[model samples]
Structures are given as C-alpha cells and as structure tokens.
Target chain A: MAEESAARKDDDIRILAFLCNWCSYAGADLAGVSRLQYPAKVLDVRVMCTGTISPYFVIKAFQEGMDGVLIAGCHIGDCHYLKGNYMTAKRFQVLRETLKFLGLEEGRLRLEWVSAAEGEKYAEVIRSFTEEIEKLGPSPLRKKKAEVGA
Target chain B: MSDLKSLIKEKLNDGADAFLCLKEEEGTLLPALITDADSPDLELAAVGEARYPLGKILIDLLREYPDKRFAVLVRGCDERALIELSKLEQVDLDRLVMVGVACTEEEARACGCPRPYPSEVALGEKVEAAPGRETIAEVESLSDAERLRWWKEEFSRCIKCYGCRNICPMCFCKDCALENPHLVEPGVIPPEFPSFHVIRALDMAGRCIDCGLCEEACPADIPLRSLYRRMQEIMEEKLGYRAGESAEEKSPLSFLGSEQDIKKLERE
Candidate 1:
C-alpha cells in the first residue's frame, strides 16, 4: 500500500489557495477540526483579506508551476474591513478575463466566498476544484520536472 | 510648421511663461522649451513627424516651475495622455495650454490610430480612424496552445530592456512594479515568461492610452501596443470604461465603489 501511494505521488498536482483570515481561513480551520476529508493537493496561504491578493500573485503562482489557484474570502457585505472583498471581486474579474485572453484554461483559476461557519462548504469546494483541475491535467505553463526539482 | 512657431510666439507674449514643442537640431527633431519670444530657437520650432512623450516631460516641467504657465504642442495621443494624467493628479490642466495639431492621413494610417485628432485642431487636417484589429483577431483565432506558443516565441526575444515602460507617457509611478525584485526576479534574462509581459499588460489595463509608443520603442519588435490595446478593449467590455476618454469619471478599478456597483458587476 505504501508503494502504491508513493507511485501516486508522481502524478499529484499542486494548487495554491489564497484564503482570507477573517472568513475563509477560519472556515478552512473548521474543516480541519471537524475531520472533513478533502483533497490534500491544495497548499494555502492565509492573507489578512482577499483584497490584499494582487493579480500578480495569481500570475506568479501559475508561472511558478501551480496547476490551479483559488481565492476565497467573506461573502459580499460581510468583510471584516467593510469593503475589502469588493475590490477582490473587481480585481478577480479583470484577472480572470486577462488569463483567459492569455490562452490559459478558465478552470485553472476560481474565486469563492466561504463564511467562517461553512466548514462543509469549504471541504466540498476543495473536492470539486481538485476534481476539475485533475481533469485538466498539469498546467501548460508549469515548469518542467527537472526545473522544478532543481 | 511655421504656423506652430507663430502660435508659440503668440502664447509666449500672451503671459504664458514658456512654450514646449519640437525643434529641428542637427537634422533631428528634439524637444525644446522656448522662454523668450524673440529667441532664435523659435524659428526652428517645427511640428516634426517623430513623436516623443511630451506629456511625460511636461509633468516634470510643470512640477519644476510650479508658478509658471506653459503652452505645449499636442497630438491626439498627447492630449489624451495629459487628460488622463490630470485625472491622476500628475498634471495641472489649469496651468498648461494645449496647442493641438491634427495628424496627416499618411501619419494616421501608419499609427493605426482610432482618433488621430485632438478636440481642437490648431494645425493639419483631421484624418480617418484606422483601428488595428488584425493582431488581436489573429491571437483570438489561434488554439490555446498555439496562442501561448506564439507569445512565448515573441517574448523570448526580449532583451530585458525597459524601453516600453520608459517611453510610456501615461506611466508616472515613481516606484515601478517592473523593478520590484519580488514580482520580477533580478538578473534573469528574458525576464520570466508571462510574468514580465503580463504584469505590464495588467498594469496598463485601464491606463494605457493606446499611443503605440511602447511598440515603436521595442527593439525586439514585440507587439506591445497590440497587447495593451487588447487590455483596453477588455476594460471597455467588462467595466464600460476606456482610459483617457473622459474628463469627469475615474476608472472603476481605481476606486473602492459602492455595493450597488459590486452587484452590477456580479450580475454581469
């Protein structure tokens, strides 16, 4: 079984998630505490707010070989800073359109709103997003295996 | 061309502190700031074919001479840049007078400019709009993999020269993102694929005036203008906003708007 799991690791893909500390991060923690089973392919960075997530971060994540990127924050009108998520919505629209224009698959990037209480929702988001990314295989912009290892 | 010289002289005598225009020197046109009406350099003030980021220079000049009023020779793109810069608080529109010169038909066709004349024409006749959509359509027609390959091949030729940024008139940020080590790694030749170019394209989204100077300045012949023009089109399609086209309203992306605005965007 250990050998089989090790073999599976070679085909594993990486995803970078930017979660807001106010809502999405707490929601992710709830998922962990509730023992929810979600895909382990996602590695998350907790930001103070989703507004702090620059479009550059998304671009850099793709350029650095991540198969997918996810941005989650408070629901509209529920931001800790009152209006941070509004900027996120606006920036995400532009960034998504930009990535699409650049020929990247639309499924590679996503944005969601997960409240701190929605642990099940958080887990389900990860599972569905992971499944979608798996179907797309590796990113076209991913660095070669040798380059990543180096 | 002599008409521009007299207009400059007239403005200089009419309480305007100085005039900023191009003058032929050693058979090449260069920017000249004439302070005296009787200066011999006034005779050399000719609206040459070559274009410079005169608005960028005007920003510095206005800041340096805070109390002086200046007249500037402007083409369509220059006027648009100054209008946008004024919105950004980089230029004092009240302190500067614009002398608009319409581009010739041949010049307008060469630039692929949509609007080649300013609001008020001081010289030359207005030409028909020649929009450049061929490149944008070409990229759109290609498959995703083929499109990526095309851009990568074009970008790989980049020598990391920042000519595109330096020549941009609307670019006025003191601390440039292009130089940031975190965004663009230092000492990397060809600058990391899609990072450098896409960063620039994103930054130019609602800011670029589509002047075509960056493409002109590019030594590697990267289609910088086409990239930026598409960005402008995206802004127009998504937000119904175009840079340098308005005098009252700011770019929606530049502000923290109301909940109603968010709702409208979400529905779309």
Candidate 2:
C-alpha cells in the first residue's frame, strides 16, 4: 500500500482549478465539448463568481497538498456581475505577494481570464500551468506518507 | 507630570465626561478612568513604560456611553491605532479628545518604533524613529526553504492562546475569523503552521498599525511584529496604502473602487 502511494506521489501532480460559473466554468465546458486536450490531473470547483473565491480557499488548497491552483474568471470589464473580477484582480496581487513572501514558488498559483467563448484559451492555460507546476515539482508543503502516519 | 494632571483636570471641567490614562498603583501602572476632577486617581496619572490596548478599551467605553465624551492619553502607536480604528467605524473620533504623550528614547529603542511621538506631544521629547527592519531583512536574506523552515519552527511553539488577537487594538470584529472552526480547526495544539499565522498576516495586511503589542503579548516569542510589519510593507508597495497614515485617505482594500484604480495598479 505504501509503495503504491509512493508511486502515485511521484507521478501525480494535483491541480485544483476554481472556475467562475458565468465564464470560466462555461469555458471549461466548451473545452470539453470541443474535445480540447489538457492535463488529466487538473480538478475543478465551480463557484458563482470569482469574487467569492476567498484567499482562505487558495491557502487551504496548498495546505491540503494541491500542487497547483488556478483561478480563471471573466476579464475585467466582461464580468457578468460587473466589477466582480476587479476585486479578484486586486485580491490576487495581495495573495500572490503573500505566498511569494512565504517562500512558495510563484508558479504554483496562477490567475487568468477565460471568457465563455474562449475554449482554446482555457485548454492552453491548463496546459501551460500544468507544465509550470511540473517544473517546480510537488509543493514543499505536501506531507510525506511517513510523516502522515506520525 | 504636573502639566498632564492639570491638563486632565482642565479637560474634565471643560466638557470631557471622563479622562482615561494610566495610574500608578503600588509600583504597577494600571489604566484608570478619572471622571471627577478632584478624584484621587487623577493625581496618580503617570506616563509609564507599560503599554496596553487602550484603543480597544475606548471602543467598548464609547459604545457603552454614547453621549459621554472622553480625553485619553496616547502614544504615537496608540494614536495611529485610534485613527485607523476611527476610519473603520469602530471609534467615533469627533467625540474624543487626544492627549498625546511622546515615548522616551529608551522606550522607543526597546520597541523599535518608527514613530515614537504623536502629531501633538503634550509630554516628553520627540525622539528619532527607530529602525525596525532587522528581522525582516534577516528573513529576506535567507533562501525560500530556509525561510519557510524558520517560520514553521517559530510557529510550532504557538499554544493558540489568542493573546495577540485579544490584545490587538485594531481587532474589533464581532465575528472573528480566528474563532471560525472552518478556518482554524479546534482541539489542535499550536494550530496548523502557516494557516494560523498566515491567516492573521493576510488580515493585518492593510490594517495593522505596527504597535508591537501582538509580539509583546505573544508567549512564544514568534516575532509577530516583524511578520505583520512585512504585511504592512506589502500593502504600501502594492496598494500605496498604510494604515493610520492619514485621516483623509482610506485603505484601497476597504472599498470597491472604480476600474481605473485596478488599471493604475496594473500599470505600475
């Protein structure tokens, strides 16, 4: 059992994507219907708006051993709830700077704009972000199997 | 000292309902509320080295007695906290009068305070601002892994006493985020590393007044002042906002400003 977990740890890079319901979620859906190929390791959570994504969720993702987190939503003026993404942009800066200051690699977390029509763009963001996270390797915050028992 | 007593007396007689200041009691200084001008406690009012969250106390007092007016003694840090708290709608500045007291050189040096005197000093000489970035610079100098390890080691000693939150003057939230079981798990000793401290750091980014009270209250000696001080620096660098700097300006995070504000920040 331990050996199986060890192999999984080496081969799997866990990625959690937070997609806003209005835009990014639709974008991901479009990517699926369009049969666009992306990393299978990526998992997603759908929220009503990007503004609802708290900094705590991002921190919790990393704490729970997520190797990478991507927050994709509508572009600045294109937000369904107008000005919702503005808060996301502002909050992203503070959260990114904070994580960077805490010695977390900058590439592990990312923010992007994916409109409902931008299926290709959503796939591309996932592709590139996965590559970046893979390069940075698993998060240092991830606890080993031995330590998990202790 | 005599001038401060007379000033308190004058304020009490001239419309102030009561005066709040520290009083010497058996060699220990305690916060005392002087309501009457002839109260014997008025004579014991002394600007001692001991510090407390007087701003937090005032918030409760002012809320309890809506119509009453107060004149409270303030150091530079205390004044800044009150100003920030007033902006957050926790304290009504119009109803209170400030009696500023500057810290001595020794006190300033011990605290590593950048601003040791309030805008108006009614007592003590205004000493030079102390350079308080040694810990920050030291941590910044280390590698990312080393820094993370250092913080983990420091935070592991936490007993989750919440003294830092309790003693903080700026903390007035009725529903505290720290107490939320979703954020901080219950029955965990020392709380989870980075989560407990990082949560606080994020919250304090644009609101901390750098009073060093959290560090003073911390039993673990976690260098919390430096952590929060770094948060303040990030606020200044990213958002061009510092808590307690100006009465007219508010923190950018406090409001949902126009799109131009975000553009301006991005362009920078």
Candidate 3:
C-alpha cells in the first residue's frame, strides 16, 4: 500500500480553476481560512466575473497542458454585477459544447456555482475534481509539450 | 447566362453606379468592378466555376465610394455573409443591390451547400443542394477517447496559416482575436491543440454562414464547415437562433439576454 501510494503521488495532473471574485473566490478563501483539507492540485486564478473568461482563456489553459478546468461562478440571480453570470452561463454552455464537439472529454470541463458561505462545498468540489483528473491521467497536451512552458 | 447579362444592363440602367461580379479574362475568372458601360469588361461578366470573396470586395467598394450605389453577384453563402456583415456594421446594405446566382447541383454537392441558391436567383436553374453531414456523423460516432486522438492528429497538421481567416468574409475585425498573442501563442506550431481552433469555433457560434470557404482555404484541409455547423446547431438548440437567418433578429450573444434567457441558461 505504501508503494501504491507512492505510485499515485507520481501521477502528475494539473487542473486550472477560474473562480469569480464575487462569490467563488471568496468561498475558496473561506475554505482556506476554515482549514478545510482539500488537495492543493488546483491553480486558482480569480477573475472579476466568469463572464469575462473568454473561451480563448479556457482554450489557452488546455493548450498550455492543463489536465482539467474548473469554472465556479456566482449562483443564478446572485451576480454581483446583476446579470454577469447570465452571460457566463450562455458562453460557458457554448464553449463546453464546442470543446466536446472538438473531441475533448466533456468531463474535462466543469461549471458550478459556489456561494461565499459554501467553503465546505468548494473544498468538496476540489477534492472530487482532483480525483477525477487523476483517473484521466496526464493531459494529452502536457505529454506532447512536457515542459509546459509559459 | 445571356439573361444574366441583360439583367446586369437593366440594373445599370436602374441606377447602380457599378456592377461587381466574376469576369473571365483569358479563361481565368477574376472579380471585375465594372463602372463604364462600354468598357468591354461587361463582355466577360460570366459566372464562371469559381468563388471569390465578393463580400470582402464589396466592403472595400462601399468604404471607398460611399456615395456610389453598386450591384454585386452573390451566391447563397455570399448573401448570408453580406447580411451578417451589415449586422456587424461592416457594410451598408441599403446602397447595394444583390444579384443572386445559384450554384449548379454538382458544385453544390461538392461544396456541401444547404441552400445552393440565393433568395432572388437570377442565374442558373435552382438545383436542390443536399447538405451532407457525413463528417459530423462520423465524428459523432467515435468514442470520446477516439474523438480526442482523432482531433489531436488532425490539428497537428496545421501550419498556422491564416488562410482560413484571410478568406473568411465575416472576419473583418480591425484586430482579430486569433492574431492576439495572448489568446493564441504567436510562435507555436499547431498553435497548441484546441485553443486556436476553439477560439475560432466559439467566435463562429452565431456568426458562421456555412460558406465552406474556410475549408477551401485551409491548407490542412480541416473540416471547418462541419465544426461550424455543429456550433450553429448548439446556438439554435439553446437560444433558438441561427446566424444570418433573418435581417433584423440579432444574435443572442450580442445582448445581455432577456429574463427568460437568464432563467433558461441557469437551468441548463
């Protein structure tokens, strides 16, 4: 079991997480403050709004060798900008479908809504997401460009 | 094609300052912007078996000669491009008249045109062009793993040639997102899998008019039209919208959205 655990440690998976500043980002912060034990595999980038996360940003993450991507935004009717998350919903839907059509696994991209109060939920999400990426192995893009340059 | 010539003459008499269409010069078809009635260029005004970016040329003409009214030859896809261009404020549709030309059945089949003829076809017999989704079907049939491997191999052949964007009539932005180094890494060959192509496909969601020009221009022979058609399907399915279907209806992406859209998007 020690050797098996060591083998699991060798599995390299990089997950890029984009959290909205208003809700999801604060929730992640709350998780950190609460000492919620979750895997540290996620690289968090906070945006003012998920609506501003152009499909190209997600594409660039995948291209740069991210094994998976997580987009967590404000809940419906809870956008700090009133309707920013509405646009996020539409764009994300289209982007996800386009990615799927282009042959990326639908599981590789995920969208969720996390409130600032839901630190436990955010931790739970990251734990599950990290496990999922582990099962999927390293990204094909990562394998090709092993250095995964900036 | 004689009727086409007579129609051109009629339009010239009907107040159009210039007629822009394909003119054969020594058996080579090229776009000719004919302004003089007796210039003999009109003699070569034949709709030869070639497609040019007539919409792009029209945009230039409209910009240069703002006061002049011009008539242009438009295939079905060209018509859609102009309609979408007008919506984008790239072209003033009011000052231009469209001369519709229908693609022959053979050309239509080869090009996979859904509507092979323009709305008001003035040339050729209207042939029913069956839109083939063979590539879409094949790709859809693949398992998720197979699909990923297939696309990785296909996109690996890209030489980063901007022919797809250069020839696309709708891509008239002063600063194209594709060229933005931040969006698409400048020096990377194959431009990092999925990003280069995904950026384009997202932009094309409610905008691509199924011209097949991008595929024709593609050196790597990427099945761009099929990919775009799938984008169109998602747009229609999710928002009940298709690009260039009507003149006044705006793309859902353009607006913030109605309350219904927000609710629907939230649920989805």
Ranking by DockQ: 1, 2, 3
Top-lDDT structure, candidate number: 1
The residue ranges of model 3 lying beyond 4 angstroms of the native Cα positions read A1-10, A145-150
Over A27-63, each residue of candidate 1 has an lDDT whose tens digit, in order, gives 9999999999999999999999999999999999999
Off by over 4 Å in 2: A1-11
Put down candidate 3 lDDT per residue, B91-157, tens digits, no spaces: 8989999999999888998898888888988888889978988888898999877887887787788
Ranking by lDDT: 1, 2, 3
TM-score of each: 0.96, 0.95, 0.92
Among all candidates shown, the one with the greatest DockQ: 1
Give a tens-digit lDDT track for model 1, residues B1-268. Answer: 3388779878888888999999998899999999998888988988999889899899999999999999999999999999889989999999989999998998898999889998888999988786879998999898878888888888999999999999999888999988999889989889887799999999998899999999999999999888899999988988888998887789878888899889898899
| Model 1 docking tier (incorrect/acceptable/medium/high) | medium
Docking class of 2: medium
Model 1 misplacement above 4 A: A1-10, A146-149
Better of 2 and 3 by DockQ: 2
The CA-based lDDT of model 2 is what?
Answer: 0.88
